[model samples]
Target: MASTASESKRVVIVTGAAEGIGRGIALRLANDGYNLGLFDLPKAEPNLTAVANEIRTTCGVRVSTVYGDVSQEEDVKRLVDIVVQELGSLYAMIANAGICINRPLHETTAEQSDKLLDINVKGTFYSFKHASIQLIKQGKGGRLVAASSIAGKRGFAEHAMYCASKFAVRGIVQCAALDYGEHGITVNAYAPGACETSLLTGVDEYFSERKGQPKGSYMEVFSAGSALKRIAQPRDVANLVSFFVSDDAAFVTGQTWLVDGGSVFD
Candidate 1:
């Protein structure tokens, strides 16, 4: 339902559309006149649909959903297919589905390691692979954006496996950008620091427990490390992604942008 000023609406597929930075990116793209295919875990259908409806009513753009786990390659492949089928074109693919476990490296378990790699690293790989294939096939260069973290820029104490996975995301973006540049597709990432989300709550709790401090005490420590002396909002990250997903960024690729408000310089 893009306005008549444009004859066609560009489409974007956003994974992890249920909450956090994913929801912020989806909403931001909708407001920017993109028809959307909102992807998330099956359990997130209700929340995802609510988000989709809000976009449709408020932005007057077409919005659809695909519920599946991002860890499975087949699931992610089908996700892009559904997006193309439902939305009519795939203009941008934002692989924003990621998870982190906050625990010391020595205490990390194999199960936790596998889960982290599967969802954070492999999930991004699957998304980047399938979306790039579709874009190449379409013969129209497109944007592929993945979620990284400040931890991706450098290692974190209690977030060891999480850091490794995000580092993998950055590597994949760079490699994919190199491989796909000839076809006109660009690959990039958005790395955010602590934000006001459940993910931050998890971080705060982990540090709080290790420091023997109250629940929110450690979050203040995190905020104070940032040059801005404030935590970023999800929208802060989403705004940068909006640029990467736009024609304005067509010439920019193979870059991992820090949305961390000077928390980490790379």
Candidate 2:
């Protein structure tokens, strides 16, 4: 059993907490003294458990792990309920669970696009809705953060539907920010460029094959395109999320920040 929440420490829910950027954010927030409610799909049980245990032992912060698909409204609602029940109060929600598919627009099918939108767009919507409801009930100001890629800001080749879904996420964030501002809930998104994650690995593989280049050649090209002349690490993105959820950004909302090493200048 986990310890009860300390009033001094805030509690947050991070979806897709098993791996990649989600895992990075979880570890960073735990170290920052935030109790965590980590959510991910059932297939990610092993990685999720490991992250939970690591945080418990190292950060000594209370953590509650829940397995569910974010695309389901019931699952998201239950996730919020359980997290509050176990961790005490919900201070913020990080809707980082999303999927990507790399394929040309012409070759993309309805099924592929639907699945991508279901998880990336619909999943984000559900997370925002439930988290907002919980925060309003508590009558405490909170943060709502979601994953929006640089693709959400600009179109990329072979990322048709994926871009569409992320674009929708930005719209949702902006709208939610307006709707929830009066309730003291801030909404925003973090848009990462070519990050070193499994999602980028898939993008790397797709371009490598399409271009007939070596395995890592496309990744090198992606790295060079950024102003930093390198790719972003998971921790890099996590840092932005930390600031967004902190008191430092209480007045900042309805904006999608690009943490892409200056890849897409907005």
Candidate 3:
């Protein structure tokens, strides 16, 4: 679809739109009548492109794809540049790309830690920076939403790096909110507990193996952590993001809202 074709609609960029939470958020925005710039890794292009097409067909919204890594500044810059140039104005950016590898603090390798931080922490920082720049340029209010985690609000054993990265996300959201509020920009984060996504498969397996239980037992362990006794769905996270980017949340900024079925008290 032509970028200008959707110019009349508010455009939002969703990184990691190929699957999981990113996909849910993208579709939700499209359903809400916003144009989209969907992005994911080059390896995920086929899936990302397919998702873009589906959103365009089902939601009847303009959808474009930007295949690149979020951890790199240059890639993020190019991604944002393409969004503004192609999709027109960028009113919101959802930095939802993330990965989690379950490893104990002592067993966590330097390489693994670096990779997680580069993608989870630096990638989020890049999204907030570039999105804020575009919003400031537009001279209109905008939303900067990110994915934090229960690990962000509180530390967990064997999740040092992940906790640290998510904590940084919350910190960035608060700082960016304060720094950009004068310009009518709001920054916030959605911190979900255990969600039903491929991202949690490794963690679930690790716990099950440790307990000598079957595959599904780990999911139960996570559910028990929540007061509601259930894991969150991707759509739950997407719904919280929808609120963050909506006009209803204009007064809300610099806050990290937890969507973990009462798992983490926030």
Top candidate (lDDT) = 2
Number of residue pairs clashing in candidate 3, backbone atoms closer than 3 angstroms, sequence gap of 3 or more or interchain = 0
TM-score of each: 0.96, 0.97, 0.95
What ranking of all candidate models by TM-score puts the best one first? 2, 1, 3
Task: Give every collision pair in model 1.
Answer: none
lDDT of 2 by residue, 196-229 (tens): 8998898888899899998888779878898999
Worst 10 residues of 1 by lDDT: 1-10
Candidate numbers sorted by lDDT from highest down: 2, 3, 1
Cα lDDT tens digits, model 3, 18-131, are 999999999888888889999999999888988899898998888879988889999998989998999777999999999997788999999999999999999999998898
Residue clash pairs of candidate 3: none
Better of 2 and 3 by TM-score: 2
lDDT tens readout by residue for model 1, 1-266: 22321356888899998999999998888888888889998888889989998998998989889989999999999999988998788878999998879888899999999999999999999998899889999997888999999889998788899999999999999999999999999899999998888888987887888899999986787689989998889999999998998777879999999988778878
Worst 10 residues of 3 by lDDT: 1-10
